[model samples]
Target: MTEPVLTVTSLVKKFGRVTAVDGVSFELAPGASLGIVGESGSGKTTTARVLAGLEEPTSGEVAVAGEHVRGRSRRARLRRARRLQMIFQDPYGSFDPRLTVAESVAEPLRLHAPGPAADVRARVDALLDQVGLSRRAGDSRPGELSGGQRQRAAIARAIAVAPRVLVLDEAVAALDVSVQAQILALLDDLRRETGISYVFVSHDLAVVRHATETAVVMRHGRIVERGPTERLLREPAHPYTRLLIDSVPRPGWDLERLARDRRALDAL
Candidate 1:
């Protein structure tokens, strides 16, 4: 069996008296995608933050490529960042208003591996192209682009460093259905091309189903169900998971369909 690229053991995060993440644990093999699904305040984002090294865990262990993350020293933080990067939900705010797309993507590369300006420009252009952005788009600020364009730029920045794992916290929740599909496809393509792993956090089950092979359902700061994404969503064991799956709106799932199903079951 291939070793997991990312592992979380008994991870817990507390915000003073509030227990945001409670003893959550999971693993993702290299090139695999794992979805973390839950409603608001269910600790999905908190877990992603902990994994991304943005928020220090109150207690627990997060290991990347078999090496356990240590103290929050500068070196440790830098190491964690190089091993894993995060794409936050807010694409608009994630980038600086003044810096253009290329500048934003090149910022991390320069910080982590500074080199000649020409080399950085070359890498930035390559990354922009990889994310389906034109060289001209690289010169535009985040506000000048559409929402989907900004998001693609954000993805470019996240993958520019070639991190082993990506922690995506509601990464597509704000986009329209069409744009969301495009972004999801881009993410899968990136995984295939780079062999990178993902820890996808979202409340949207349909989006999760499209992006992940395996999934974990969280409710009130604890994992309630976990398994292959198809099986878990098709036959959710936990009541909370069932509620989440049912809450998603579907075509032909209106009063008429519900009544029809009720009548069919009654006749049976």
Candidate 2:
């Protein structure tokens, strides 16, 4: 079996009296896509933060590409940062308001690989194009762009360093439905092309189902259920998992249609 590119074992985090993540453990194989779904305040974002090395865990271990993340020296932490990048929920908040889109995307490359000025510009341009933004977009500031465009620019920056793992913390939740679909598709394509492992954290099960092969359900800082996405959705094993699945809004599914669909499935 291939070794996992990212691993979290018995992870725990506490914010004073509040337990944010409790003994959460999982592994991500190289290029694997894992979706974590939970309601707000369920500790999903905390887990992502811990994994991305943005927050230190109270206990347990997080490893990326076989290197330990916690209790590392400053140099070690910087090394980990180079291999792991995070995409925040709000793209605008993450990007510098003063910096143009190109500068935002080029920031990582500059930090990690400071070389010829012309070379950095070329690489940034390529990353912009990779994320479906035009080279002209490089000149525009974050405030000038639409929500989807800003998110795309954020993605461009996230992958600029070619990190092996990308932690998406509610990355698409803020976009409109149409833009969300497009961004998700773009992410799917990027994963396929780059073989980057993704830790996608979201509250939307429908979006998770569309984007990920595996699903882990988190509640109150604990993982309640985990399995293949289709299996978990079709036959939820945990009560919390069932609650989450039932809560997904299925448009046009009135009581009558729901009953009919249940009956049809039962007949199968």
Top candidate, metric TM-score: 1
Model 1 lDDT per residue over 1-268, tens place: 9999998999999999999999999999999999999989999999998898888999999999999986789999888889899998888988999999999999999989999999999999999999999988999989999888999999999898899999899899889889988999999999999999999999889889999999999877999899999999898887667656655677755666555654653465
TM-score of each: 0.92, 0.92
Model 1 steric clash pairs: none
lDDT of 2 by residue, 153-209 (tens): 999998988899999988999999999999999999999999999999998888899
User: Which consecutive 10 residues in model 2 have the weakest lDDT in total?
Assistant: 257-266
Model 1's alpha-carbon lDDT is 0.90
Off by over 4 Å in 1: 251-268
